[model samples]
Target: MINAKEAFLKASTELKENGIENSTYEVREIFKELLKLNPFDIDFAQKELSQSQEDLLNDAVNRRKMHEPLQYILKKWEFMSLDFNVRSGVLIPRQDTETLVECALEVVKQNNFTQCADLCTGSGCIGISLCHYSKGLFTQGYDISDAAIELATENAFLNSCDRFIAKKHDVLLSAIGKYDIIVSNPPYIKTQVISSLQSEVKDYEPHLALDGGESGYEFYKAIIPLWKNALNKGGYMCFECGEGQAEEIVKLFEVNGFSQIRTFKDYNKIDRVISAKLL
Candidate 1:
């Protein structure tokens, strides 16, 4: 029977050979999950694996070999200091998106926008995080997909945003009430680029949460104008954009009559958030 250390090394090597970039961490998380033992736990240090435990490790190894996202396997993901439940149909919350939340919080803090809307609020990460951090704001989250709405509500509840409402509303067609701050990390990966993404994203994640049309700015184009009437006068709009999209997104807001257009960079210095106010 294989021991935990031997099992982990073998699984890590196999995952690496299959192109998993973070093989060691993946293997460690898998071991900790299956054995219910932390890496530093004395029990893990002394335990011998039973046959069932060995089989579970082998199953996880095989799943990893198939390029399944570790987050999907774990059914949870972290964003903005919170853990969100994730399934195959929902977008996996990403750290890059935290920049959107941060920008929104800062805008509200600076301008005192207490009513906000999170459009295309998959998993409710943006609005929920804002509610958690902003304290006094009333936040609402909307998504077109029923599955996404369900998961978003669950996430909102988990994050203690019971006052935050998650609803099913397609941004392309729905008429939402005015808000002092509007924000989204909408689907922005170009349709063509979707197929070219790493398998962990292209294969495992929801296409509805990706596939941002031919030029990758369809949602921004469609929603920015709709938001023109939905934002209170002098209210702010902020969005998370894909790489190389900040300038075009700023242009979209400008064309829609938004002023004071600004772009902020993520920690990696990528132009990741675009902010503007209705003139």
Candidate 2:
């Protein structure tokens, strides 16, 4: 007999008490999904909750209480103006990664690169967004994890980026072709730092996508040389980096023959992107 508003408030309060961040928004979204009601529609409805709906809401609340990621509970996430299916095995696309996409697009626009590669294409967010934003640019995305490749492929189709191809190939071991532009938001969080991350990330997200080796620059080290070999002269490479990691990544690129290196900051003024062109 509880009204929708009452249920939402109760759920929100419970979630907050359990240390879940964004409790109100999480509860509201759960209510919306269960009742097929929007936030505004919650108050107008007088219908009783169905048994299945009640069960779903309760399960979701419990999961949130455990500090599970909201995206995992919902089984989907949004990035770059598109919806993507996500599960525990795949790293959820984050807003900060969009900065990598924007920077890559700018490089492509400035240099008119017709082909690009998205290394470590988790969920296909970068490559798919590139194809969506860059007209006539052919994009190829590579991931070492099979699950990541499957999910990225699904995301590509979901975003209507059929021209974008997602492949399973380890950047560290594979021989890749030269590209005009290459962008990656690779795993940059140091291995030792993984356990200290929020539960939503360390517990729920895939470790394969979060651990960047002991120094958190394993992928950067492995890819820089490969990128140097794979990018045409004058082609560009961009990486989404963790704070304090941009300079080290830039040095890697520079030592491997990249030039005109530069880093771009996110809205918070933290350096989040590094860009350079092949010599």
For all predictions, the C-alpha RMSD in Å is 1.6, 1.5
- Pairs that clash in candidate 1: none
Model 1: worst 10 consecutive residues (lDDT sum): 36-45
Q: Candidate 2 — which pairs collide?
A: none
Winner by TM-score? 2
TM-score of every candidate relative to the true structure: 0.94, 0.95
Instruction: List runs of model 2 lying over 4 Å from the truth.
Output: 42-47
Q: In candidate 1, how many Å is residue 272 off?
A: 0.6
**lDDT (Cα, tens digit) per residue for candidate 1, span 1-279:** 667667767888999999998999987887777665466676564666788878888888888788888877777878898878887788888888888888889999998778999998988888989988988898888999998899989988788787689988999886589899999998999899888899888888889989899989999999998877888989999999988999999888888888999998898999999999888
Q: Ten-residue segment with the worst summed lDDT in candidate 2? A: 41-50
Clash tally, candidates in order: 0, 0
Strongest candidate by lDDT: 1
- How far residue 183's Cα lies from its native spot in candidate 1, in Å, is 0.6
lDDT of 2 by residue, 1-279 (tens): 556666667789999999987898888778765556566763445656666766787899999999998888887877888888887888898898888898998898888888899898988888998889988899999989999899988888888887699999888886488799989888889999999998889888889888899999998998888667888888889999999998888889878888899999986889999999888
